[model samples]
Target: MHILALVLVVLPLAASQLIGGPTTVDVNRDDVQQMASFALTQLNTLLGSQNTLVSVVQAKTQVVAGIKYFLTLDIKNGKETQTCTVTVWSRVWLNDKQVTQHACTSRTKRDGLVGATTSVNVTRTVLKMATYAVTTLNGLQGVHNSLDQVISAKTQVVSGTNYFLKIRMSDGSQTQICDVTIWDQPWSYMTQMTHHSCVNAKRRDIGMPGGLFNADINSPDVKNMTNFALGELNRLQGAQNSIIEVISAKTQVVAGMNYFLKIRMSDGSQTQICDVTIWDQPWTHMTQMTHHSCVNAKRRDIGMSGGMLNADVNSPDVKNMANFALGEINGVQNAQNSMVQIISAKTQVVAGMNYILTMRLKEGDKTQICYVKIWSQPWLHRKEMTEHSCSQVTKRAGGLLGGVTNLNVNSGDIKEVAKFAVREINGIQGAQNSLVKVVKAGYQVVGGFTYVLTLSLKDGDKTQLCEVNVWSPAWTMARRLTDHHCTAQTKRQLAAVTDADVNDHFIQMLAHYAVQTINTLDGTHRAYVELISAKTQVVDGTNYFFKIRVRQGTTTQLCDVTFWRQVWMNSMGHVTEHKCATVRRRNVGGVEPAHLSAPLQQAVSFAEDALNGKMNSMFRFVVEKVENISQKASSATTYSFDLHLVSSTCRNNGNSYGKGITDCTPNYGMLQRMTCEVTVEYRPSSSRKYSLAADKCGQIQLV
Candidate 1:
């Protein structure tokens, strides 16, 4: 059965109908319709398909950063047997940027389809959908820029009496993002609608109103002065030059009236300065025009240059007015000056140098405040007077010379700072243990009276330098500076080395691997074996550091000889008490030091079997004591060592059980012994080269 349905796909409904959020009612109807039309056109292209019918099912509207519309459409395509649903979204922003998106899926078809449409009803369906979409979009809000115009129109449309919108610009002090729009009305159509504009809610005025006068500058004398002033102003404006002048004119003031200055020129140019004085200033009486000047004047030792106030008059009225003006200026300065404070500081005390002095002055007081930083020697002279407010004083004065008072105020702990640095380098996502320790701390002369207290920190292979600048005088809290100069102890500049025959080079490379293996064991900063010594074989035999003794019946080889890895003090002979670490474990049955000249035990076993008459195997081997390695090329040098082999034909010099001795009788042991010297080139590189040979002699067979 073919069901016929015609549905319109459109933008979202009014914000009020969707949820309790902002409604952009203040937007102009024309602009809103234009935006909606643009969005609908784009939607058509996105949803266009061959032999497909689409209809709007539902629309949702929301208001957050801007207006957003979510539209649900029912889609049917002749190519597909199943129906699908498409969701289209459109977001309109205040900056005239519009974004629209749509997605279609055959997953689940919503139940709100008006009805199915046959081929004959297809044209009707498309027209109905387009019309509905355009209508709905035309009613949607436009870009917020035209908010003011929409609000004004709305106020005039009903009766030209009621004002419905107020526009307010946002300042940092405002807490909420506000958008004002008119309430949706039934009589207003989308094509002819107006909107409201967001505005800062007016703050209630609690202070009692004072008496003030509304001035008229239309009088003959006033008109002449205003005309001249206007001419000067116009000339300045034409030249695009700034004019800095004191405006002083005689004008009569009437109590309890609004003041206005209106200027009119013959050429139809006009100028007006209305509401020159708010309710804060009151005029007592109307009198003949009198001259009042405050040109670079000083009253009560307060400099009033660049400002005009009635400080010349001794009358109570003039004094009150002057006091009020001074109070306001002081209040503004105080707020700005108190924003910063130096709670701690550091400074250098020079024996004979003279430093500039800093001091704070009282409000409205013009006296210079200065205090020279001095020592026992003769004071140096400075001619300039450095001016500083409360905030600038601490920073400009070098430091609080007296000392710090609060050590904890506004200062980060040095150890904590170092730990944070390490964590960042190691990529730790959360807080972890502080791995650095302060080594040395002292004050250093930086510049003038400013000094930075520096600290040195060491943690395993990491080192960090920290500097703290605390206020002097009462050294309590710091201002402006605290930092850590992190230096990884293990970090080294790569060196170019070509020597591959040095024994130290191979040992160094092996040592580095051992260090890495040790670090990976528990993943904590631990001591590394920074240096390795070569094998020392004495006459008593395998007594060297790299050699191991295999007893008569033991299967142990030279590889079993393990070194206890620990960190040693670079300057001292002893190991580090806390940073020292145990040896790293190997893949074998026992743990061993990673730093080694070679797998000596393995080499020895291979050599013994190869030289023995039983095994028809051959292997070249070497053993040697690592000699001195130059400090400059230690990181990149390859090492070489001489391998010494001592083998002999011998039987187990002990008794064995007659029944269990399958391989050899107690006295007759199947063994061959021989001695030879071979050289092994040990490269710190990934590959090692060795030369080994064994020839059979009459009684001794060497392979």
Candidate 2:
């Protein structure tokens, strides 16, 4: 089976617990803070709620075509503040930013909070609702860690009663406190366990001590035979029942395998303990419930308005439901977590059936434990994954073999391997190439992770590309540089396209993205000035190498940027390689692009005023080149411009901006002498004016 190489998606929700993800970042940082606030802003716009951001609780970042931020934000909703989670994806290069999966942290706050009572008045009806909540919990989970007496309860009345309770719970031995919330309306026979969280969430396998004679309720085979009998029992009584669990069950080989089971079940209002017998003949595909007994129940005919049936996950209809759940979750979840197996399942009869499935999902080389609730009405061809939650299954540190893997270039592990490769190469005896950063990257999974990378190295005064391969067996904690080679890029070469092709929208887009990535990685802040040339190469995926001109405050620089995209492997393909080194030029001229935006034109006009203000020069600005104008602070902007002249004029006697009238003593305000450069900061909010910052102005006169 060919598995898609694009597995660098969101980690399961559970994995994003107190910490965000493997790539956790500080919540206070400007970028992360911006994302958190933006998520709330988008939430306000989409949900039409003016919930302002209170604080960023946590942040998890994934490096895609842009940065994908998984944020936990605290927001002031109204009277009570709520903690919410959201995903914000941003590709600053393409000028695209979006918010997805914006929601409250807990269902209690997320749903039915509008009219829900703030405090609970424990009336007689409230106690009954608590009992109903426990009954439903016992049905879904089985006898294992069965819910018991409710120590306390908080109720929210939204059409139905919602119970948030701290309950006494125990599997077989130790009792623990479980905070569970459920929605119930006895008249409608609707009881759903909305949220379940425990203080000690981890539990050991409750299988019997090393002995074959002891019954193992956790065994799937035992569950299959037990639930099969339960299904038959429900059908017989004309009653819908939910299984608390198969408390104790063992199989015996006779005419067919005989299953003796002790199960816990609930019928809407009360819980029951049942002893059942079943004959399972796998060869004939037949399973029959022989006899059954329940505590304090003389009548074998109990009628429940509507109830849940403990389902053998392997059964035909139940298996179909599980598959339905998988499809729905994968469709909605940005991370494509495919089903590995149905660990357990239960079906509640509603208009059709509601299947609550606990499944094992495969994400990359890891396994995730998922709980998905699906409502599927096949007759109506309607199905939805109602609720989903998954947590990363921690694997013991050891050998993990995988197939051809196309992973995220920005993954923590991927970058670690790339850095290791650089450390290995730079330390090589008499190595001439001093590598700086990873420009482009790809990887394969063999023993551990095999990283294929293109690196930019500082070779004398020029920037060069180096291809390096590193094999790191993460299990063994070892790294090795298997092979390495370097290439000194000569003058710009258009391999697959002519100079005219550089203007192609597709090419220009890639060029712009590459230049953006370089600016982000480069120490000095810069923006794109010109795309001098671009080359495309066809390989397993497309390879784009571009030579672009960028400026950092009054500094002119040339950078070679390489971008690799395997049909959006992880993002707009990842910025595989980026190299930027300032080119020192004397009397260097500037080139102008075809068009500029309105904001950019306004920025230049402001820049002229600032220049004329700072330097007593009537600056008749020659419109040499206008590259880009990007927002710096909330109200400020950074614009890149090429200067033709900045002659100092002592007075502003009604002289329009950019026009120099009188020559000053050449001693006023710093006359920055550089080849050709200018930086403008526009703050229209605070001071409706621009401040001038220039470089290499006096040395190379703009002709």
Candidate 3:
């Protein structure tokens, strides 16, 4: 009869109850919902008839003497969905359910926070009293605490009235935020400062962390020193690393000037955060790293294994140790030698982040690549620049130039590198493709030598291109492909992506979809035959070049098709045909022929009628592109012509079919872009219709 019974009977009991255990049950389970319903009714009854049951939003069950339901209910309490927490004990078998504790909050009236009513607005009277209380505290503690601002306050009515205040002090640095209490009884003519204390983070310096200060993040001196530290790291660590830009910088003057920098640096292709410290002593011409640590873009440690491991130019240990080393170098040169770049470096942890490096550094206008080694411990505040040798950096061939790049490919070294990469090819992809020749080659020095070779691999009768990077050390004959990508070619080549066969069903489907999408622009219903050939070039995305055979009416023809949709699009069933063409497709479609035959006139008529039927009901339209396909003399498919049709509109056209919309656009939503089709041929007499024309799905003339 009550709302609780109405709710309980409506919900089906779906939760399995286990006896003698507390279980977490889905809140939406029917049994939980049913329990929630009963709990809400009991809550209403226990709390008088004031609060009404809105909905049972959550429930937790404990199997006790019967079942105890910990319920959080959204009640109809005049305001928005205010929450009412209710706990109920139920023995459904005995049909006995009681609202154990209706609120979770005290069910009975209770004084708030030991009988003090809190208020946020600190009146002038409250502040004056708080000041007096603080004064009493200061006199007793032998300190000064002038009031700045009131944070919070509480008032209690006793024989007279008392005020407790929390405030920020204007004078005291450590005890900025403190609590003070004052007893006031004006009728009895009594006033006394009773309490003074501190709470939470504000107990000291208003919750600020120790030894932390804000500094200009874009300080120039900081940048220069930070850059100097990074350059030195690349040297000592033998890393090809460079800074992107500075994020933040701070400086402290101690034994010298210590720079604290946070910056983004590039270690090969990865960009990471480098927290670097560069200690510079210009007066003594000494500069070196104190510390350098790197974290990923997410500000999480990169988990670099410790050792004399190869590190980025931004590695904390490398940077700091190098800074110390550089400072010592400056002291030795006394010529203000500044680091330009690190050519190569190797470091092994000894006392601290220490390094032996070959570096390109600048002394005034002159720069030299030098062999330098340095070691230091920041805690000891000492360093030793052990070795230094230099030669002016010169432009020369056969020298180790930095970075991965395209270089001369006709050299003897190129040939050797190609052969080396080829020798390791069998281990690559474990496929049947054999190397015919190397298409191109580039090299970079990384500990050893790495060659990026674009190879022409032969698989069956197909020739596909595979680009692989092979790493080979100078001495050993062992060479390994670090990375590679090879594609499939019809019967000619097949990519061995982990030993998958060439006749994979997936490959065939892609081949078909790719062909149809290309011809879709021409609107020609050509049946796809066998795949003649298809090859892929790997770049940021794959470029698929396909040679597919398809049927037109009674004759079979070869179409050279190209598509740019992502390769995964085919497998994901989201293939969008971006581009397609017949064999010599580039030359296949172009300008409309010089003369239109009588049949061309009638065929053009049919095409216009079909397209116009699909257009907006209000206005007949003109197609922007007209492709002229005439029966060729030999094996040629069709020649196309691009015709730009001017539209008769008052405003400009930026491809709004969201171009010419409302009642003027095509009926099939917006026929935004039409690449192919609408082949209507009628050859009765020399009937010429001057008004008809189209685009990929454009212009028309009968043949």
Candidate 4:
């Protein structure tokens, strides 16, 4: 069966390179019919075998030309009536190096057991003895050159560690193959193998272990050997479990399987374990472990490579943890407090000298307090005193005593109190060197008051002043005393009139005059006294000089009266000369004679008539009456002596009294009557008075 299998495998390679080779094919008589058909079948079989081998060789040659590894085989078949010869030629290449002309020959004969009627059987065998003899002879010549080439090709290196091995037939045909070997460490080799194994394993058929090969171990079948080897490596490498261990050389602790250990170098430069076996661990630990050194006894958490666990967690000095926490809390509190204080201060209303100040403390609590102090000046009191007698005295003074009130003190009142408080401060008196008294009176009003004094003295001398005044309700007068006699008298007589006596006399005289004046005039009328020089006189012949002002109720009146009796005697040198004249005038009559002459009478009459509203005009009456009357009077005697005398007096006096006289006159008589009219315009008793007078005279009269 093995020989048949070998024959079946080799028969297809006999067509192309071995043109004159023998070929064989198997047949069953039951499936064949006639002799011609049998022969045609054999021929077709032989030709088909050769053509199939040639096709395979052509395909392999195309592959070798295009790619790095390839194999090609050619078969030549020759057939006789009962015998056939087969020649096989093969070409193989590994990574551009090639060996050609490897050949093998075989012979086949018909053989069979007689079946029902005559059956045919075929027998094939490699011509080893004949091929050896041919090979030995070819070796002596260059016919074995291809064999040497094949031997050289087998020893040639192709890939990194792969070599080629060749097998050649005695007919100058060959088959080429590859032998691959990896020189890497078991771990690296296994790691790569593991990846390929996993890929293949995933594609395996059910119940079949991947890469199982049914080839001889001594001469491995290259077609499936690589796959089988990779699977074995995969099993070996994949068996290693990932473990955690400290790598002192790398200053790291790592977790990974053998594959990771094989691929990565433990240089501190690469701190992270990137292997898939260690992928389940935390990344922080992975990195940290890769960098950890044996200098520390314990492994740090995650990325921290140095410092003890207790030191990192418990020591405040390294982190300032307490201060940081406290700072956060204080910052929030301060902000809140600032806001509260701002609102409080903003809401508070201040007036006058008060101010609102906002401040914040440790916490957020807010308080608003107000302060106020009333402002005012101090009041002063004044006083005065006078002496009436040795034991009788009166005093009077005025004062203003007042103080500030309604002071409101609030939470912020300290500054206001300090600013406005009044101590016993110094003060100045209105009048220095003047007798006065002063006292503090303290804060008499709601707030406080200061007092001072104003004093007046009868003698015009006062005492030293003081700061304030003492208030009192009293009246007193200042007094001075002196003594003198009414007349120039001897020293003894003046001495006899003591101060009291002189004072009494003066008082009595003043009282008597006051009484007489008051008795003679009503209260609305003021009384006055005057002392005048003896030479002073009035038109009424009275002389006295002194001016006195008297006030009755609220009215003040000035009056000057010159007494004639006192003044006349002083002028007459004590002679009673005016007594006889006064007596004669009185004895003759109480009325005086008509002293005015004829023209004066006429003028008076005319003035009287005109004043009686007889004339319609102002001065026309003078011309009409006086001129006409004078013209009619022929002789001086015809005019009345009164008229003549009055005219002469008017001429002597040079009086332009026509309007006055005319306004006052009446109808004319023998001597025209002259009139005198006085009009008094009186004001109210409280007002000033005025008067107007009119007199009449003749218009044209001889004098």
Which number leads on TM-score?
A: 3
Query: What's the candidate order when arranged by decreasing lDDT?
Result: 2, 3, 1, 4
lDDT tens per residue, model 1, 535-596: 32111111113221111111211112222221111110111111232333222121121233
RMSD of each: 38.7, 31.3, 29.6, 73.7
lDDT of 2 by residue, 1-703 (tens): 1344334333444355423223668988999987777787776554434677877877777766677787767677666566665678889999888874444532244562333444432322334455455456567756544433345667654544567877655554444566778776433346788897665423332111111133446444666776786676575455788875555565443223556687777777666777776766553566666556666432232222233445666555556666667666677666677778886666665676687677788879977767777888768988888877766776555334443345576678777877677666655533555656666676665534667776667656655555676765443355667656544443443123323256454565567667545533442235455577777654455577788876654566777877886531336566787777776744434433225566665666566555444432222333444442344554567776664443342333334544322323232232323224567776776554666655334432211
TM-score ranking from best candidate downward:
3, 2, 1, 4
Candidate 2 vs candidate 4, TM-score winner: 2
Q: Which lDDT values do the candidates have, in the order given?
A: 0.28, 0.57, 0.52, 0.22
Number of the top lDDT candidate: 2
lDDT preference between candidates 3 and 4, better one = 3
Error of 3 at 210 (Å): 38
Indicate whether candidate 2 or candidate 4 has the larger lDDT.
2
TM-score of each: 0.16, 0.22, 0.23, 0.11
Model 1 residue 408 CA deviation in Å: 26
> lDDT tens string, model 4, 485-518?
1111123321221121211323223322432333
lDDT of 3 by residue, 516-610 (tens): 45443453445555565555544433555566666554445666655443321213122333443443222234433224455553344345444
